[model samples]
Target: MKAAFAPTLEGWYERHRRDLPWRHTRDPYRIWLSEVILQQTRVAQGRPYYERFVEAYPTVTDLALADERELLRLWQGLGYYSRARNLHQTARYITEQLNAEFPATFDGLLSLKGIGVYTAAAVASFAFGERVPVVDGNVYRVLARVFGITEDITTTGAKKTFAKLASELIQPASDPATYNQAIMEFGAIQCTPVSPDCLLCPLQQSCNAYQTGRQQRLPVKAKKEPVRNRYFNYLVLRQNGKLVMRERTARDIWQNLYDFWLVETDEPITALTDLNLPDELAKLVQQGRLTGNPVPLTQLLSHQRIRGQFFLVDLPDTVSMPLPTGFGQYSMDEINQLPKPVLVTTYLNEWLG
Candidate 1:
């Protein structure tokens, strides 16, 4: 079966692959960046970011030397902020410790920050022409359907099984980059998660799942847990022409990004009078640090719900308010340069209107 899989996949691939930007280059650095960006992100959504990152940091050395704030700023809209941080750190590791040289082997790439097994295999095969199998969501779906595997694809056992099977099927004689792209593209466009275009698929004649009338059920996914909701009250304090914003630190979701001063609660506070402004906030009001009254704001996340308030405080002057430890005041223009959570941006555009 493994003997047949590679030729079948390669044959389908040669005639039907999308011409993408990353596909044209075999540069490991670029490939590595694409792989990292595409993690937990769709290709369509990631493409623009990929282009921006390539334009901004054209080399491993460029990414390594970029300021963390600047990197995070560019990655603002993309959730999963950790990926950007890891990418920056990994570039530094490759340039400084490895002397601006990328690891030629799978193990070496895997050792860098956030380079997991999937990324390592991808970079190794695509950039270095190593005959290593790449396994991602697409591969899992395609293989499971073809083989009628019933185990939950999220389990460790399923991963090991899929990896082993993929390894046996990788074409040793083929261009690794082409082969990798072929399988992935086939899975994405032909063997899609929803209704697949089986008629256009080259493997339609021999596909086990199609033959068995179980294409929808073969690649079983584990059920996801329910999303938890959270509430946030943001104070959009303003003085003169500047707005008060703070940087979120290591413990929060948008770590190292700037946002308005926030007070979170489990339930929605219907009225502004209900808010218990912290001592610092009271002091700001007493000192005429606010320009306008506190306004209510609400936001939602995949797993969290936020109910917030915005206080357009008019400051007597641009005197810096005492911020929470690790937070600092930024001007409104400065806010534009800092990376902020999407929710913060939403609040800003809504109230500032």
Candidate 2:
């Protein structure tokens, strides 16, 4: 009976699948590109970035040669920046070490930076025609409800269970790429996270959760970790028609992306009056080198809530500027060329646009 459903799914997939750009290609680079961009992002949101990336870096070698900052600039506003960083790293490894060939085997793909089991399975089957099953969030949901799986979808152990079940169901000699694509698409558009259309669902008649009326409760997800709040005070410092920007080198959020001079706090400040500027800037402030009023902004990440305050300071030529290493001065045109955080970019776009 489970084997019978595979053909039903493939048939439904052929008739109802959305015309996504990645589906029309067998290129491993393009397939991997789509999978990476779509991670933690909606299809509608990720599609443009996928298109832009394919245009910008047409091949794996092109991606490997890309400057990290330029790649980050292209990937701005798409949170999970670590993905962008790893994507570049993987591309470089493939180009230089693998002779521009992506790993054809699932385990080989998994050996690359940022390529986990799910992503590895996706590329392996979709691009290489491997028989492995791809068990992503979508697959988890569809299988949990249809097969009556009670395992918490968030746990690591659930992956093995779901993968085993999916592998069993994949038809012999069936196109694993098409089967994988069909299941993911079915989960994306049909077995959605919210309010799935069970009434018209193809598997409704045979779905165990649907029959048991537990569809909403079967694919249980673990509770997300509690988020911490951080306060940021960005100094948009300028002197002699140039602005100061620094690269985040520490093992922190937004690593390798450009940002302004920052003062972090555990609590929000009522006013900029309580700034603890470095000695050089404080001395310049004694002579009143500060210009515009501080601007306030807020950013929300997966595990962090950030309240940002921007202080615009204009220094004089006579004043000696004290900058830490990994910092640079750039004109607006040059600044436009560097990759920045969306918060920084959004603020600068108004001033520079």
Best by lDDT: 2
Per-prediction TM-score to the true structure, in the order listed: 0.63, 0.63
Candidate 2, run of 10 with poorest lDDT: 281-290
For model 2, the stretches where C-alpha displacement exceeds 4 angstroms are 171-173, 225-353
**9-45: candidate 2 lDDT, tens digit per residue:** 8887998899999988878999999999989899999
Q: Model-by-model lDDT, in order?
A: 0.80, 0.85
Task: Tell me the deviation in Å of residue 151 in model 2.
Answer: 1.4
- Candidate 1, residues 33-66, lDDT tens digits: the string is 9999899988899899999999999999999999
**True lDDT of residue 159, candidate 1:** 89
Candidate 1: which stretches are off by over 4 Å? 171-173, 226-353
Worst 10 residues of 1 by lDDT: 289-298
Candidate 1 local lDDT, residue 225: 60
Instruction: Return the clash pairs for model 2, or none.
Output: none
